[model samples]
Target: MENYPTEIQEAVKIMYEMRGNSEGMMTWKNFPLAKQIITLLDSIPNRSEHHTPYDKIFILNFIIDNISSSDTPRFTIEIMEKELALLKEVLPADLEEYNDPLTAEDIEEELQMWRDYIDTEHFSNEEWCRKYSHYMKFDPIERSEIWEEKYYEIESKIDAELMKEDMPRGLGFCFAYWSSKHKVLAEMGIEWQSPQEMNPGVVFD
Candidate 1:
């Protein structure tokens, strides 16, 4: 993989943690896989109030597409296959049939719902905040910006690893577009680069 190891471990962890329990090798295909997975890893909360059934599926697909598994300590290919199958089962027929991708407002609303749910269990929304008491006092925007700065720095590590595959945005928008599709992360104004972070100055943008 060119950037960020391009595996799905993060997705697995996110999905598993979403239920606040462990599904072992289970994954949902109901929504955008990559996005939800990211939310999970990012410790973003869920909000059924903000999304319809279809939006949930979109979220699954989004996270599944973006998270990597290679990051796991002893993950097996069999586990990956099982998770993939489960994901497929949860997916809606013809995701492309829908247009008008979600907006930042949509993400915020959904995330807020998740926040309300987790608040009873997890004190702070941000992962770092939960880890450290100091971060708990920071405003939402401030915490978001802090993470944005960190992600941007990570981006610099793999800025130049573009491979130019048959990306969803056709090629021109492959780099920046894909990166910005992460609404919460995008709000921080950070660019997406390779997850592995090996090359630099080789992005499509």
Candidate 2:
């Protein structure tokens, strides 16, 4: 098996931590089987340079989901091996040959667009408090709705600019994973501000 890339190795380590901390695995007796399956997955060739970490994250989540399904351990290492083999059969021999239309430049552009929009947009005091107040004080569902509305607004702008008929599967997954405003801002190396931080003199009810 090929040595795992640094990012993939890190992802595997995170998966191990998740497995150890999982509440459902307290009495599970299949640590060895889980380890074997994860090791096998760690060796799988990454499908894309930019999407490898996301792919590994997806695989780790799949493993955990399956492992947590039963305390008795429904699947064996051999079964996993067969499944991996079948998966490999459908993969391209040189996955690098496939190019993702969405580049890092594109991501950076979208991130900047989001940042600028957030920085310039004005909201009423009540709406601002609902959107940016601390989680405990304000309704989280309302905050989510505001963020969702903003997210779609930005996404529509991006779609119009790109004008691509179909987004690649891996990029689609990546976008889905980082759907929230905080996550998107973090990706852009920006920190989200609280209501108090953004409006020092303003008081919230």
- Identify the runs in model 2 with alpha carbons over 4 angstroms from their true place: 24-205
Worst 10 residues of 2 by lDDT: 68-77
- For candidate 2, write residues 19-84 as lDDT tens digits: 664543222323444555567655766455444433543454345454432121123323333343
Name the lDDT of candidate 1.
Answer: 0.37
| lDDT score, candidate 1, position 91 | 36
- lDDT by residue (146-203, candidate 1, tens digit) is 4433543333332322223323324465345335334334555644334223234345
Maximum-lDDT candidate: 2
TM-score of each: 0.19, 0.21
Q: RMSD in Å for candidate 2, one decimal?
A: 19.8
Tell me how far the alpha carbon of residue 80 in candidate 1 is from the true structure, in angstroms, after superposition: 24
- Candidates in order have lDDT scores of 0.37, 0.41
How accurate locally is residue 11 in candidate 1, as Cα lDDT from 0 to 100? 53
